[model samples]
Target: MNKTDRLLAIVLELQRKEVVRAEDLATRFETSVRTIYRDIQALSEAGVPIIGAPGTGYSLMEGYFLPPISFTVQEAVSLLMGTDFIEQRFDDDYRVRAQAARGKIEVILPESVRNETSRVRKAIRLLISDKQVTPSKEKEYLEKIRRAILDERKISFHYVKKLADFDGNRHSVRTVSPYGLVLVQGSWMLVARCELRQDIRHFRLSRMTEFIALEERFERPAHFNLREYTPSDDRHLRVRLRFNQDIADKVKESNNHYIEDMEEHQDGLHVVLRVRQLDELLRWVLGWGADVIVLEPESFRNRIREEAQKMLKRY
Candidate 1:
């Protein structure tokens, strides 16, 4: 193991047991007694609660504690990588808070540990694009929503819904009991209890304008399950498509829903998917452009052809 790993292991070992002999640690870490002594001194200088006596080895000071800094190596790497990714993708105050939290972790880390962390952080990256115009009001609303969610308090928010086919016709001014927030398909959604519908609903956060936390508190339902709220009605008829080699590779990389089978074709590729709804599936299939061809379900093919004809006539 490297120096940082050895040091982390030493601290964890000492925390688990009341005392660990220097000779035992040296043997476990495959180092000499002198090296172990130096490591202990390093830990002490780093403000670790390490106490020792001559020949009695070392022990963590009783009741002297460090703030909980527990994380698996993979978990730590993921957090560091995710924070860096968000820092570039989001241009909001939340992104600044995330970066600050990452900085705090690095500041408290031992020099050796910090160096290892930096190496990992430098290796991961995310693609950047045009800057998104994040609304300042929405950012403030998110801050309040986050605090209410953490504290398990009721929050009242005015939600607005824009009509799809009608211009200047929209629905606004509704209140909800906020449950949780999630990011799905590159969009932020607030899952909550709709007062009018009396059912759980997911509201896109960007669409919500005004929000307020209520003075009343509500207990989270004991049977509330977040995973159960996602859209998973998969009983609709199936559809098949054939895509070119390049498009097939992209689909494989995404690893998303409704991929039943794939087979190589002389010209391109063949793929099948079982979809529950034709409208949503049509949108997704058309998104692939000419790279994909409809192969089955004549009803869906007819719908696509009709839509294409309508668009051509409009043009």
Candidate 2:
């Protein structure tokens, strides 16, 4: 791109990140470090609140805010759809705020843009509102946990594991330094440094029976990065399975992380998977019902048999 565009891009990049190295900027812009430096200097001269520190990288001046930027019809529609999807997914306070924000954006849009947005919205619809699947208390508890995370405070919660204890409950109290919240496979998980585990632990939001934000504050490690955190690094469980012809195409379409390989056959399709846990795979196989069958891993077959027996007993 041209010099003016590069300078604006640099400003936006710095705004998004806490620190950005000159070398990284050079690589991103496909230019020399000298050129990146010159661009930074140009932005600084133009009264952009850019901060540069030795050894560390560049940042926007703390507390400096960017002026509102205009969005095209498509961009506005996408943003509105995003807000709508979030509303459909959760019944949190975020929904109200997002709706308010969308209204404000709609009110401020140019007449033509507003007309386009109205037309565009009429063509798109998001009907899925499955808030009942999530606990009503979850949104309130989510707010409490979010506040704790932002303030670098600890959180205390009573969690009930899916697998139960003698009394059919895997309930326990835990204290953790709030680190990150991750959404995976329709579940909200809190990844934290657990005092209970004496290590990083993942807690499902649904399992948390009670939660409290603690007054005790803690220092977040300078090197701590939520983006690098994976809830489970163990992908050791390997198994082979087969799907009947009825679901051969469906199984292929619902591409899962565990899928390692596949072989097509006249009657069915054989597949291999590398997964973290057997129960995780078992639940997925169960979802497919008669359309799927475990081809290998005798242990998996046994578990399926046991679960099937239990399910039949219930019926």
Candidate 3:
């Protein structure tokens, strides 16, 4: 970035936080400490009230504030689209707040920029089908869960597992310390420390019933960071399958998430899927009928064979 842009960004960064270290600013701007020092010197010379301590970091002087910055047409459109998405996906409170925020943004923009942003937004629309929109019940649950997480409280609910046992037992009661919520593939999932399992678990809001936010408070772990957390891979099972070459394009178009890799082979298309259990891919493989063949894991092959045998008997 040019010196002018970098200077502006550094000031903005300082405005964002109470104090920022020179090393942090250097890393953020992809420059050296010397460059950052020079940039800070330039800002100070230009009459930006910057305070720097020897051991501590740099900060803007008390009560110092920058003038309102203007947004580009693209930036305005992006903000408008974000508000639209929140209005569609979030709860009623956020929907109203988003609408109000949109109004504020619209009022602040220049007339030409507003007109251009409106034209751009009209051409590019964010549309969600009725099925993709968050249901009313789920939105209500989201608000409750959000409050619980913020308040550091416990919540209890009846959860229905996606997979059922042989005896058709899939319901379980859970009490969890609410940590954070994640939106995955049009579904709201809660990542919490489950008291029943004594470990962190992900629960889909759609599968939860009898939800209640308990008054009992719990301490969330200080080290737990939702943005950096990744689910363990030790439980993943690798299942390899071969598909008829004729349907290779169709398989690719399906865009299944668990599919880790695919390779073209002389015999057919070699597809490898990583799932938590073999049954996850069983129904999908069976959907292709004779066109797909399970190529590995004797247990999975045997299960497929048994299922095919049952199907034949039924026929």
Candidate 4:
């Protein structure tokens, strides 16, 4: 980056953090320590309130901040689009905040840039299907869970699993320490320490009902991080399938998440997928009809045979 841009970025970085060491700044900007020293000197000469010490890092003076900066048309659009997404996907509180933020941004933009942003935004749309949109109850659950996580409290809810137990009971009550919330494929999932299971587990928000935040608080693990957590892989089953050549391209376009490996053959494509249960892939495989073949796991073949025979009887 140019020196002028780098200077501005350094100031912004200072505003973002309480302190930044010279070495850290050098690594972030991919420049030499000598260059950073020179840049710091230049910023100091330019009347910026930068304080540096031998061991301590650099920091700006208290209450010092950059004046309002101009945003390019593209940058304005990106911010506006972010607000739009937040409005559509977040809770009512955030939706109101996003609308206010959008108005503030639009009011400050240059008229020409604002007009161009509006024109460009008309061509780009964020389409959310009904199934993907956050439901009313889910939004309430999200807000409560968010508060619970922030307060380091436990939450209780009744969850319905995808399958029933031997007694045909699918509903169960759970009390968990809220860890974090994750959005996967437009659905909200809660990652938490399940007290009943005595382990961390993921629960879909949609399947949760009668939710309440408990008054009791719990201490979260210092080393636990939701971003780096990976579930155990022992339960996952590997199933291989062959797709007919004609629909191979379409299969690639589907971008199914569980697909681990794929290779092209003259007759078709060999695709291997990992899923928690064989039933998880049953409907997806059936969607391809005769064009897709289950290439491995004779049990899956028998399962398919039984399903196909059931379909034949119905026909």
- What are the models' TM-scores? 0.61, 0.80, 0.92, 0.90
Error of 4 at 216 (Å): 1.2
Q: lDDT of candidate 3?
A: 0.93
Q: Where does candidate 2 stray beyond 4 Å?
A: 1-4, 15-19, 41-67, 127-133, 164-169, 253-263, 305-315
> 1-315 in candidate 4: lDDT tens per residue?
999999999999999999999999999999998999999999999999999988988999999999999999999999999999999998988999999999999999999999999999999998888978999999999989999999999999999987675698889999999999999878899999999999998999999999988999999999998889887875468899999999988999988878999999897899999877788789989989999999888999999989999999998
Worst 10 residues of 4 by lDDT: 229-238
Task: Estimate, for each residue in 1-315, the C-alpha lDDT of model 1 and write its tens digit.
Answer: 988888888998898888889999999999999999999989999899898988777889888655677665566777777787676534466699788988877677677667777787677656554444335665567777777877877776666663332465455565666788776655567787777778777787788765778777767787887777565464567888888887778877655567777788897878778765676577777778778778888988898888777878999
lDDT of each: 0.75, 0.84, 0.93, 0.93
Which candidate leads in lDDT? 3
Could you tell me the TM-score of candidate 2? 0.80
lDDT of 3 by residue, 133-250 (tens): 8988999999999999999999999999988756888999999998999998789999999988899999999998999999999998999999999977754788999999999999
Candidate 2, lDDT over the whole model: 0.84
lDDT of 3 at 86: 96
Q: Rank by TM-score, highest first.
A: 3, 4, 2, 1
Instruction: Report backbone clashes per prediction.
Output: 1, 0, 0, 0
Question: Which of candidates 3 and 4 reaches a greater TM-score?
Answer: 3
State which candidate has the highest TM-score. 3
Candidate 2, pairs of clashing residues: none
What's model 1's lDDT at 275? 61
Off by over 4 Å in 1: 1-79, 85-96, 131-138, 151-174, 210-217, 225-235, 251-267, 274-276
